[model samples]
Target: MHTSKLIKDTPTDRIFLFVLYIFIGLAVLIVLYPLIYIISASVSSPLAVNSGKMWLWPVGFNLDGYKVILQYGDIWRGYMMTIFYTISGTMVSLFITIPCAYAISRRDFAGKKWFTNFMLITMFLSGGLIPTYLLVRNLGMLNTVWAIIIPNAVSVYNIIVTKSFFQSTIPWEMQEAAKVDGASDFQIFFRIVLPLSAPIIAVMALFYGVGQWNDYFNSLVYLQNKNLYPLQMVLRQILVLQDMQQGSATGSTISQSAAQAAFSKEQLVAVIKYGVMIVSSLPVIMVYPLLQRYFVKGVLIGSLKG
Candidate 1:
């Protein structure tokens, strides 16, 4: 009898739920609108794009923007460099961070508290950019890939999170059992702990990978050679050059028809910016879903107990 009353009450609750869902849908559209505009603008002709004729879809679609971008051989080189950096940097970061986190997670380790405190101190303080630059210069890492990867190999925040996860999730008894089986520390870590700790490791890998992939500031600071420049730096230069050439003072050098052509070129460049973002982000974005099932459990298990 009470179940029927509750069922009747659920209809009123569902009405409110429907209203809430509608608001959320509107919010999603608002967030997605700019992305939609960028895609549409990239495919649309310059005239249609600049005139604000594009809505949610392409207007008189064209591929000239992609053609122009692909014509630059430097962009292809930048793409390859970025891929290499992202992969190598993530691997190096994980190697450093995972071991450090694991060591800290063990309560029996002497000076673990002091080490953890030292790491926490780094999170709040730094040697600053100039000092770091000098250090890198002294190490002769400048203009090399190590300048980008080695300096940022161990993030304190990531270390803390990962350590917490390990402490909270991995049982001490398991390590003891592995040791009883004559497993070395390294063997136990790799054979037992690592397999069980997949979620947090995956999370850390994603964090480090994305950070390295999107990092432009490090490349800008350390890399002097254009040949060593990553995709972001190249993109920055392309945008700046496009802006300068399209400026009013420079526009006067060209005839009216030429000015129009230049404006079209500018629009195409603007569109390509969005395309580049899409291309660069697509891999990481696609990767997350495959690991998504593990993310929540990993975070929860790793965070709560530690």
Candidate 2:
């Protein structure tokens, strides 16, 4: 028979905890409200959204926004394109980033300091837009699939994080042991290092995937074919075209039927914008939960080690 003693909080500790909870609760509300509002607005009727009647929850709940988005044909093509970009680009990034980070993290790797310093210089200084554009053009990457994929493949920050994770988390003794067993460096890396690197890999994948998914500037600058445009660019074009139509309608005289059609289109666009927001963010939100465990562990350990 053992009795467990309860520890009571002192007044100072209690007061500190109370204030801390309040601040934490406020922070949560600040972050959570926008997400809730976006969801609510996406479901609410266009009139309710535009009229400001929809606040914290849906007002005059409707699903036509989603219907209109579904009917929009280009969005599907853009989705396929975006998915391809995210998957392929992430693979390319991981392939380059992982090997480079591992090599740089190794103490025996020759000229590591020089290589790291050269890479670091890129973080602050770079050729201006014209020079970069010319370089890409000279390489004939412009207007090609590789235009976006190759140019933004390696992230220096990701490399640093992964390097720190490898240096601190992976034991140098383990590598030595593997080497003594008559395993070559390549074999040891392929067999041991990669297998234990899932957390950092997942974090890198999330970062690179999200960046590729949301990327539109590269498409705008380098891509010529409308068919090559990703989901973000497609959405932007839709919004721009709608605005143009509205401007034309307002500036020019139109018949009753035309006016009615324009007004109906306006309402559809209003709701569709919010629906698009939900649809665009849905993939990332779904992915985050899957990677949450790895993300937390990787970022924490990597950051702490650095």
> In candidate 2, what are the lDDT values of residues 1-306, reduced to their tens digit?
999999999999999999999999999999999999989987887778888898899988877767656756678989999999999999999999999999999989999999999999999999988998899999999998899899899999899899998998899999999999999999988999999998889889988999999999999999988788899987777656653366543113222222444435556567667778888889889878877887777668666553
TM-score of each: 0.85, 0.88
**lDDT agreement with native, every candidate:** 0.78, 0.83
Candidate with maximal lDDT:
2
lDDT of 2: 0.83
- Show model 2 residue runs off by greater than 4 Å: 1-6, 242-263
92-113: candidate 1 lDDT, tens digit per residue: 9999999999999986789999
- When superposed on Cα atoms, how far off is each prediction in RMSD? 4.2, 3.7
